[model samples]
Target: MQNKAIDFKRQVNIKLADTKLQDALSRLQTRFVEGRSAVISEIHHLEDTRTAAAAIRDCVLNDLDSWLQKFEQQAIAHGAIVHWAETATDANRIVTEIAAQHNVLTAVKSKSMVSEECGLNDALEHAGIKVMETDLGEYILQLAHEAPSHIVAPVVHKNKEEISDLFAEKHQMSRKTGIAELCLEAREILRPAFLNADMGISGANFLIAETGSVLIVTNEGNGRLVTTLPRVHVAITGIEKVVPTLEDVTTLLRLLPRSATGQSITNYVSVLTGNKDAKAHDGPEHFHIILLDNGRSSLIGGEMQEMLRCIRCGACMNHCPVYQNIGGHAYGWVYPGPMGSILTPLLSGLKSSPDLPNASTFCGACAAVCPVKIPLPDLLRNLRTRQMALGLKSRQEVLMLKVWGWLTLHPRIYALATKIGVRILAMMGGERHLLHTLPGATGWTDGRDFPAPSGKTFREMYRKKSTK
Candidate 1:
């Protein structure tokens, strides 16, 4: 498959030309932005709550090892098995081993981005374990054999008709079925999967070190069922998900759902504290928490350490203009948008995704909406610097930047160039006042209308005003 960083430019062009994808992404992102703004506006202490949340995350990250050990000890005390994996391969191996030990035939999973990052479903399937996605959005994606487009709404890119068709082809449902009917059909199908699942796997929104609890927030009841109904429950999450205390979890929870989906809280928030009583027969008899490092631990005490504070609320992506235009699939990875731009290159290596850092408009909307206030634009810039230092940038881009730098150092030449360029553009614009294309800048004008220049540079305008 053509992936991001490798075929990003082509993918972006494809997404931009796809009117349907553009329309769907625009509506979904607009709704999410408005919803987040409306709910956050009602919180009088929004800043304080976010600040507390950031501080709590920072504390855990600063001493992450200690907190993780504490969580492991407490979880063990509560009759849970805690496993640590330093890499994605290691994590997949651990889960497969556990499934093998239990001879797990089928496993049910809730929406866990970490598991997606690890490619857990394919791993389990390769090991002869049948995996079922229980979250409605994830279930839809699973059926379609697609990756999630958005963090909060996984199948946001899919329209109802498309989904109806998918269900019809995959589940023998009528193609003419409405959305409600489709949901009902999905529910009916997933209910049986939950009951027959040999094990349940989920992602943790937050790991409470004090209580050894795995906190999960979901709109569907699938999260609860996945954790409670199976013979075994497994949670795979990043080491950064750990927090200092329950109070901290409460503070972060206030900001997470509001920033993510514009709700004060998700419909269901389940806290699994190591199978309180395995013999009770009401919940899972076996509880396991897998902590995956996957390059995150290396970020500590580094320039990008603030990235560790992210709670994965996805507010950054919702408000990003670039993300709205190109959509997530163009990003070519498990994570997308601003967070993905930074994390993908950091995790996958700068050479693997040289274009990601340059994907943003650097408008700062992402940093502004971020719950923990990660400087996303700055992070992107940092990645760009890293890319340049490693000589990963194309020679043409480097030469262009060198020429631009030279021009900027000579003000007179720069002004002269700008004035000439504007007059040329203005002439090209003619009556339409729009340039259909620009020489050597086709990428900028390919899927957008470039506004005509005013025939005068900013310097000329300022000079005339000063003379007056």
Candidate 2:
């Protein structure tokens, strides 16, 4: 939320130098990437499903006002309260005020990225309310006082041994090496919080405007407990999460779990229509939904509107080469990877996160796997162009671009320049066939060696082949 993305490169270097991080990140490809590929391949019409899902999201965005109004009317009709928040501050204030009004002392929270975006935990704590993260990944982060590194896998950046140490230190329990043992230990500690909490806070996977229900999909049972066991329940999410109907929610559900965790469907999918009725056996007495704008309204009819279609499935980041090398924290905010590169700049301001757009390799791995088909590489490139227009780039970069542009305008000079440049690079490479870091230049070379040119222009090679 704070946007330390200004330290993007520094954070990247720190994460790269960390062997433990590298070891942990190595599994991301196998776990999320390959798993998604295998699971999605099972669908005979995955592309058609994706296109339809995208269309549903686009339909919502095209007439967001009418849909939101319909949603509000339907939700109130079902006896639920809906609140609009214009900014992060407004959102936080609304939640804390709700807690205060309910006389809530202890609150339990399920994993919600929008809450993180609004810095809700700190705000609630400052308001003198105790908060507990019920999701295992989020609970671990809460214990260690660390932020989530991945959207679905919040604690992906940490290893089991580190988590074991954290639990032992924080929970004052004996160290457990087995994953199951550790999970049970966490559950043991969190059970009391679930029973004692006066209010529950959660993130919505999809908001169905038709039935006025809040839907959440989870592998663990925490989501249900957090929303039902407490007397009061509050669901906070971006306005982009709304869909037109239950069928729309169902269409997106077909892709969310597969794209996120490679599951057929999450173990628990709960649809909360409203609070407890007079005849209902058990449920929260008061239910509220906070729709957060926080800079999303500006993208409705703009070049960046497609970004609003994201389902937070994280398929794009799972395949991102840059994120593979450096984990999400380097993006320096709640969202990370390809989507973070676009959304962080758009929401937080392009000036605050100048480096995020350029963090991509333009390889299109992200776009290929995107369930919604957001053209991520093109968006990142557009951000870079905006950087140029705003004069945010260094003079050296601008000068280099200008020189490169001028050279391409003169064919003979450009040809001669390439021929001479290749020979110089060849001489520098000598027998190694690779160029080491040039003096005073450790940009790319700092990480790895650059291959030297072949010392022959493409034109010369083509002419020789033609003669042959």
Query: Judged by lDDT, which candidate is best?
Result: 2
Error of 2 at 178 (Å): 0.7
* Alpha-carbon RMSD of each model: 1.8, 0.9
The residue-by-residue lDDT of candidate 1 on 47-104, one tens digit each, is 7877788889889999998999999999998988999999988999999999988879
TM-score per candidate, chains pooled: 0.96, 0.99
- What TM-score should be assigned to candidate 1? 0.96
Best by TM-score: 2
- Writing each residue's lDDT as its tens digit, candidate 2 over 135-162 gives 9999999988899999999999999999
Candidate 2 structure, TM-score to reference: 0.99
Clashing pairs in 2: none
lDDT, candidate 2, at 226: 96
Q: How many backbone clashes does candidate 2 have?
A: 0
Model 1: residues >4 Å from true position, as ranges? 1-3, 276-279, 431-433
